[model samples]
Target: ILILFFVMMAQMVVLTLPRAAACLNRAQQVLEIEPSIVDGERTLDDGAREPQDEADAVAVFDHMSFRFDDADEDTLCDLSFACRRGQTTAIVGSTGSGKSTVAKLLLRFHDATKGSIRLNGVDLRELTQDEIRGRIAYVPQKAWLFSGTVASNLRFGNEGATEGDMLHALEVAQSTFVLDQPQGLDTPVAQGGTNFSGGQRQRLAIARALMKHADLYIFDDSFSALDFKTDAALRHALQGETRDAAVLIIAQRISTILHADQIVVLKDGEVVGLGTHGELMETCEVYRAIAESQMKGGE
Candidate 1:
């Protein structure tokens, strides 16, 4: 009788163990389902994006070199370049070749440890901070727009700017949708322009910068977001406007910078080549490699 009781107990334990495991599995599945959120929490903070570098420093760097404290070695070494009036100068390089460093120095964000930077023949170190940055307008690769109507954001760059000027800027930026929107200039743009497409955001940012009509335009990979057709049109617009003002363009695509009056190619903190597109093709292996890569990539 005792042996029969033990066999019955073992069969009951085996059957109950599987049932307990399956129950726990079902509980876990129910717990994983997300509860619907009835409403969002917290207030939305609408703020302007941080400005990079200085604006007014239409730049000239003479034998500049620098390194960050965290860096094991200098990021820029003996960098000498002059951005003059009425020409688009382009810089192209692979990552960490000190392309951004050059722009930073021009803006006086990081002063060159050794060398002199002059803005319009005036030494930048001597100029007041606001005086140096006031006349320059910049458009970064990561375009940002404040929470406001499209017209308001463009007007933010130059408060005195007119609706006609805003329309012209939008046109130059290769965007007609701003005019097509039912609200047109009155259409609201969310903070950071999150509601807009990437290309639209880029156009709005460009429109804002163009409204400033600044003496110097610093474009750091600004065209990287646009389609090829839009890019060509934007370039055409800029080309005509930039005849009297200096344009500095930093780009990775060979197609974008090929028509630049002067192209500066950097490799490891030094200029590997500098010249027109045709001149670079003949003399620069690095430029040739980039050109070939772009060709293969069909960008």
Candidate 2:
């Protein structure tokens, strides 16, 4: 019995030691790295000549380029585009084409290595991180939810939101599944929303973002999980809710961006085409090929 006990103890140590070492190495890496993005010292004044009207609140990327600290080449290369308020701009590209990097730049996750990003005529570098991010509501490709009641997760978007606001957001997101739950707004969610289906989690994430009132809305392939019917309904509702805000979407599916005011196509980290769906189909071979491929798949 003593020999068996000793063998079990030795096996346990052998199993745990490598995991512990790897965890320590990761913690050490995190401790050693400095944050690449930091808030600017200056704050925008109330009368700073920024766009006062919602229609004028525009986001512009001018000759922007970004390279990760460890990467040898730029992830985004001389990308230029404008997302204007009251219009939808969709970025579509193959994987590794840097579509999502554009959203990160706008969110100021990393400052551009070259050129400038401007909001309402002011350079992003001149504004505090909070000042820039406060005006944008972002929904990432993966939906993230904390362990709490449904109402609590929705409140993260706007703490001041009332039950009425929560209900309205759910309605707009077409997330009526919550209403059928016995707990309704109070339904408990597990960490990372493991309790919900992928489509349900996405709808909840969209509802949470809809609860906030912001100048810009960024949906980074947020609808990839939904069925075609739900996707269409949610987008229809979103148009009404975000009529005055600039909407930027990064999508892999051509169907998701067909109705966008402008579609920007990326290839190998460069802007290969920029135009409406019909315009791109006629003028850009890359866009035409993508559309044709998707059309065949759908058929």
Candidate 3:
């Protein structure tokens, strides 16, 4: 246990991490802490407490690590993060920060080197990939669309999706421009959606993700291609429409995460700051610097 602690604890949350938006560290064994309250301020009214059992949490990363098939050094080092329903978690960092890797892990595209990832308390490795992934809708950095119409792309998120489903998703994404198009949903989309503009592609991708209305939604740098107005509008719609679902947004834009319930700052494959935006600005210097530089605001 001591050895595990030292190995997991030995790294900066800043620096020495991949430049990508979000990445999970490779954990050999994650520490397990029992439910106990060490300190709490007395209150006239009792505050709502989080469920004590780890199983109640939507997701848990217990000491995870990762590396490519041939890399000598680990791309991810001792990493841990959690997500829950009704919350929005944003992971932000420069390129090579392994931001995309977190999405991959959550989707079970790659297994961890040391620790375990649990969904609803079942070890991710033990759960069949299809079983675990059924609850998530993923939007990658590149919006992957099929060779079909906007409706087809949206319906792909869920096989049972109806015309009503596609219309609702398109509305949420502000993609009503489809109606003005020559053929609407029947308009042919090239393979991987190469024909659409970057912003259009991203919005379509978002609409598809929303269609699933999965328990979890993972967006990996999914909004970088969008213009500010579109981004803002999309976010506004997402907040209202997906109020009950957990959202994980990995982005390079600070403005995108300012309102997130939690902001995870990564540098060189480590978690340098973990808190709300204000909390990070006050307590994490590296995080402040990143925010200042990215947002062009006072530090």
Candidate 4:
């Protein structure tokens, strides 16, 4: 028995030492690396100027470029575009084409390496990160939900949101199934929303963002998990709910972005086309090829 115990102890030490060393190394790297994007001292509440008009709520990227640390080349180069208020702008691209990078820049996740990005005519770097994000509602590619009641999750957007507000958001997100639950809003959600399907979790996430009543909405491929019927219904409902706010959609599907006011096609981290879908089909080979591929796959 003593020999067996000793062998097991030795095996445990051998297995855990390398893992502990790797974990410590990673933690040390995280501690040593400082974030490039820092918050400005000024805040919107402290007499910061508000946007003057619908156009002012616009997000403008002027010759924007970014390169990740330790990377050899820029991830985005000379990108310029405008996302106007009361309209939808869709960024479509192949993988690694930097569609999500544009969204990250808008959110100030990383500062542009060259040129500038402005929101409501104010440079993003001039405003505190909180101040910049306060006016935007973002739904990430992965829908995350904490272990809590549905109402608790919804309240993350607006702490003062009422049950009626939550219900309205759910309706707009096309997630009326929540109302059928015995506990309704009080139903407990497992960690990471393990209790719900991918589409259900996405709908809940969208509803949470809707509760914010923000000036801008960024949907980072938020509808990818839903079926066609649900995606269409949600988009139609969103048109009514978000009629006044600027919307930016990073999408992989052509059908998802066909109705957008403008479509920006990206390839190899550069913009190859900028126009409406019909115009792109006629003018941009990249856009035409992507549309053709999707159409062929559908058939």
TM-score of each: 0.78, 0.87, 0.79, 0.87
Error of 1 at 143 (Å): 0.4
The segments of candidate 2 whose C-alpha lies over 4 angstroms from its true place after superposition are 1-33, 50-57, 297-299
Tens digit of lDDT per residue, candidate 4, span 1-299? Answer: 99999999999999999999999999999999977887877765566564565245568888999999889999999998888878999999999999998988899999999998887777899888988889899999999999999999999999999889999999999989999999999999999999999999999999999999887899999999999999999999999899888899999989899899999999988999999998998899999989999987422
Ranking by TM-score: 4, 2, 3, 1
TM-score of 3: 0.79
Error of 3 at 279 (Å): 0.8
lDDT of 2 by residue, 148-259 (tens): 9999999999999999999999999999899999999999999999999999999999999998898889999999999999999999999999999999989988888899
Badly placed stretches (over 4 Å) of model 3 are 1-52
Report the C-alpha displacement of residue 202, candidate 3, in angstroms. Answer: 0.8
Query: Ten residues in a row with the worst lDDT in model 2?
Result: 46-55
lDDT digits (tens) for residues 1-299 of candidate 3: 99887776665433445632233332312335432212123221234233467533567777788877788987877778888777899998878988899888888778877787777666666665666667788888988888988878887888898888888899998888877899987778999889988888888888888888677888888888888888888888888886777788998888888899998888877888889999999988877887888765643
Candidate 2 vs candidate 4: which has greater lDDT? 4
lDDT of each residue in 1-299, candidate 1, tens digit only: 99999999999999999999999999999999864312222111223121244232356777878877688887888777767667889999999898877777666676666777766655656555565556677887799999988988999888998888888888888878988889999999899999899989988888888888666788888888788988998999988766777899999888889789889999998888989999998899999889988887432
Question: What is the clash tally of candidate 3?
Answer: 31
User: Pick by lDDT: which candidate is best?
Assistant: 4
Kindly state the number of residue pairs that clash in model 2: 0
Pairs with backbone N, CA or C atoms under 3 Å apart (clashes), candidate 1: 56-132, 56-133
Ranking by lDDT: 4, 2, 1, 3
Q: After superposition, how far is residue 238 of candidate 2 from its true place, in Å?
A: 0.5
The RMSD of every model to the true structure, in order and in angstroms, is 13.0, 4.5, 17.0, 3.9
